[model samples]
Target: MNTDIEIVTGFLGSGKTSFINALVESTLVDNEKVLIIQCERGLREIQKTIIEDKRVKIKLYDAEKPLTEEYLKYALTLYRPHRVIIEHNGTRNLIETLNIFNSKALKKHCKITTIFYISEASVFNFYLDNMGGFLLPAVEYSNLILINNINEVGKEEIDKIHKKIDSINPYAIIIGVKKGESIKAMVQKEKILEEGFLKKLRIFFKNIVYR
Candidate 1:
């Protein structure tokens, strides 16, 4: 089976990890071997250890290593994962990674399922005010927008964020959710599965690693 690659993206402490925690929890009911590959700035061992499921595999990458195209190609080749989830570094350039995946070699192996951006409603203004820092190109590239932490930010703010996300990239699917929810549960499979199996997958991704 062609592995499904879903990229879940977001800013730091925006409940990206929390969202994944629940996602894998639900995934255990089905697939036993789910992989979560995380790229962050500091020691996130506690978070890494927390996602320790017999079914889930966690790979952590910190410290500066030359992030060349060959590095990613090798990782994709060796891992041979059923579902590959990447927790991207916010400051990291996503286009570079996307361009690498654009290769025919990768396209033949993994299918790009979805790109989900987890956003905290409270920081919508903060990110908007600091647009350049947020990487407009990456945001524009995402396929889905997940507005999380509705309790902290409130429904009104969520609505505003929706307006903001739509203004930025109208094509991305927008889903409003709490901080922690299962990956399979958050993505309403009914709507997407309607398109058929060849086009459906479940994965998590992120864009922000830190401040």
Candidate 2:
């Protein structure tokens, strides 16, 4: 069976870990095994239930120890997870991180199914202003763009975020998620990927240029 890979990207304190917790608890089906590879440490803690779940496994990699295709292949051979979620480093270049998938060994072992970009509403513009190079490309490539901490901001602010993201990636499914909101149900209800051949073709070329 082909392992399904999903990538989550966001700046520090953007609630990327929290979103993964929600997906594991609410979106994933019963009896499914998953491996979560965290590339960056975040402020939020993984829930205890998730830590204890036998079906879930977590791995951490950082500057001292980096991810490699050989290690990834070994992990797949050992745990043999049905799905893999990679929490990408927020400051790193997304295009470079994506090159990991181009490896022949990884290509045979897994396929990327979704790319999610999460941002805290209050800090979205602030980060964009300082780190637009990192943030903009992530927005353009994501299949789902989640604006978290929506409850903390007003409608005008929320609308501004929506408008800005839409301008960058009209095909992406953008949603505002309030604190403690059930993202699993909402995200599962949407059509996550571009449906038609023409749109997929556009995305293919966009990715080529992006790389």
Candidate 3:
């Protein structure tokens, strides 16, 4: 059986570790074995107790050294995990890391389940101004874009951030989350929006052609 891989990426201090911890705590109870590989060290560390399930393992690597196909293949061989979660580095190029996963050797053993991009609402503009080129690709490639620390920012600011992200990746599900909040409700809301948008689009074209 192939391992299911999830890539979680975000800029520095954007809450990627916190989100991953919450996800693992809420889910993955029944999986046979799971592995979390961290490519960067954050100011805060994920506690062992939070993810101390007998079936789970966590590994941290140096951020300076980029992830290579040979190292990834070796990790897969050693862990033989049922599920794999990658905590990607903020400064690293996500495209390079994605390429490693796309390599024939790793692709045969693991399949990408989803790529999630998390952002801090308050510093979003700064990131766009300074790191836009590096960050845009991650936003475009992600399946879901999460704006964290929403409680600290105002609605207008949030809207601006939302519009910017939408312009880059309209198909991705975008959600605003306060610290320690569950993602289930936000995910459901995204689904409703997607359905409504499609319904409205069809009606819009029908009216234009019929009239």
Candidate 4:
């Protein structure tokens, strides 16, 4: 059976590790085997307790080394995991990593289910300016974009950021999250956002195409 791959990416200190840890703890039931390929070390480490689970395995790779198709293929063949999660480096080009996932050889073994981009709302604009075009690919390709540290910014500010993100990738499900928020709540929000967004987008496209 093909493994399901989830790519979690963001700028440095964007809470990708925290989000992943919360997600795994809450949703991964029934001893589901998970293989986590971490390309960068975050400010916070995933707790030792999470790793103690027999079903969860993690491999940390050097961020300087390119995450090539050959390496990914070898990892997949070796682990044969039920699901794969990549904690991608903030500085790496997301498109390049995604290309490896898109390769024919990798496709036969694993398929990418979702790409989640976690953005720290407070420093979003700074990164956008400093990183230049490096950040666009991840935002454009993400299935969901979570703007973390929402409590640090007001709703108006968050909305502005949301609009900016929407302009780039209207199809992505965007949500604002404060600390201590439940992942289940975020998942629920995604469902609602996706449904409403898709409905409107479909109507708008239909009108344009028909007109």
Candidate 5:
């Protein structure tokens, strides 16, 4: 069986980092190694926090200016991970990134099992309005849609958001694929429930810096 490669792709404040943090905490058993191929420069604060506290085995890479096909090829050849989960830079062309990943250099090393397009719950409607432009492009660009922060957005908004995303692509995985507030919750050593203005600012900075 081909090892699953879950690529989390999204725009700023879209919640890719949180989703991965959730997956890591849930799926990664003690000592079971997982590689996080981060397409960001230097150390991201949230990622660092997860490293400091979480007991799970992880390999984090900044990818310099941003890891390209060559960098991915290098990682695959060097790391040889059994299961690879890449968190794509939101600003990058993920379709093209996947295409490059399938290049002769790295195709044998990895096969994309699923692509999660992580985004904000509040912005779902706005994205849908631009379906022909941004929404459709993002939808067509991914295999699954993960609407985050369901707790804050509540069931009613979540339902509407699901309809909006599904209307664009009925074939896409809508609900179970939905990854929410778990990112921040999972990363915390103490598991704090507090999400304040600073939290929003953190997310905003993360999106812009990573964008």
Candidate 6:
């Protein structure tokens, strides 16, 4: 089976590590062997439980070196993971990073399942104003856009962010995670709902065709 790749892009202190922790603790299956590759060390550390889990392996790389297909192939050979989660550096260009997965060498071994762009609600505008160059591409290509620390920001600001995201990537699933909420649980619920809706639509079409 080809290993699934999940990319989580966010700035430092934007809760990316915490979200990854939730994914490992609650979302992933018990039997799944996961390889987490961190582009750089963030302010928050990975949860201890994840570090102790034999099913999960962690690797850190220098953000300056940039991720390459050669490194991915090496990781695949070494860890033999069922799934790979890349905690991408927010400052890096996502398009360049995504291109590595499209290379012929790594294409057969792994495929990208989801690209999640995480942002801190309180500093959403600040980042947009200062780092639009780095942030825009990530938002445009991401499958899911998660806004953290929503409770700390006002509804007006959140609405503005939503409008901006919709303009950039209308198809993206945007979710606001409030304080004390589980990011993995929320995202999993959204995925389940989307799958359920698609299944119902397929049945409806089948009935129409048969009738």
lDDT of each: 0.60, 0.79, 0.77, 0.78, 0.60, 0.82
- Which residue pairs come into collision in candidate 5? none
Best model per TM-score: 6
Candidate 4: what lDDT? 0.78
Ranking by lDDT: 6, 2, 4, 3, 1, 5
Q: Which regions in candidate 4 have their CA more than 4 angstroms from the true location?
A: 130-132, 180-211
- TM-score of every prediction relative to native: 0.71, 0.81, 0.82, 0.83, 0.65, 0.85
**lDDT: the better of candidates 2 and 6:** 6
lDDT of 2 by residue, 1-211 (tens): 5677889998778888888887676544555678999998788877899889898899887734546777788888888877888888887878877787899989987888889999988988777778877678899889888888799988898887888888888998887777877766565556443335654454445345434
Looking at candidate 6, the ten consecutive residues that score lowest on lDDT are: 192-201
Residues 1-211 of candidate 4: C-alpha lDDT, one tens digit per residue: 5777888999778888887786666545453567898898778787687789887899999888878898888887887666788999988999889878777888887888889998888988677767759998988889888888789977788777887788899998887888778654776555532234453454345335433
Give the clashing residue pairs of candidate 6, or none: none
Task: Quote model 2's TM-score.
Answer: 0.81
Model 3 lDDT per residue over 51-107, tens place: 667778888988889988888788889987767889999889899888888778888
CA deviation > 4 Å runs, candidate 1: 28-32, 41-52, 63-68, 132-134, 154-156, 178-211
lDDT (C-alpha) at residue 5 in model 2: 83
Between which residue pairs do clashes occur in model 4? none
Write down the worst ten-residue block by lDDT for model 5: 186-195
- For candidate 4, what is the TM-score? 0.83
lDDT for model 6:
0.82
The backbone clash count of each candidate, in order, is 10, 0, 0, 0, 0, 0
Off by over 4 Å in 5: 1-3, 41-66, 131-137, 141-143, 151-160, 176-211
Cα error, residue 146 of model 6, in Å, equals 1.1
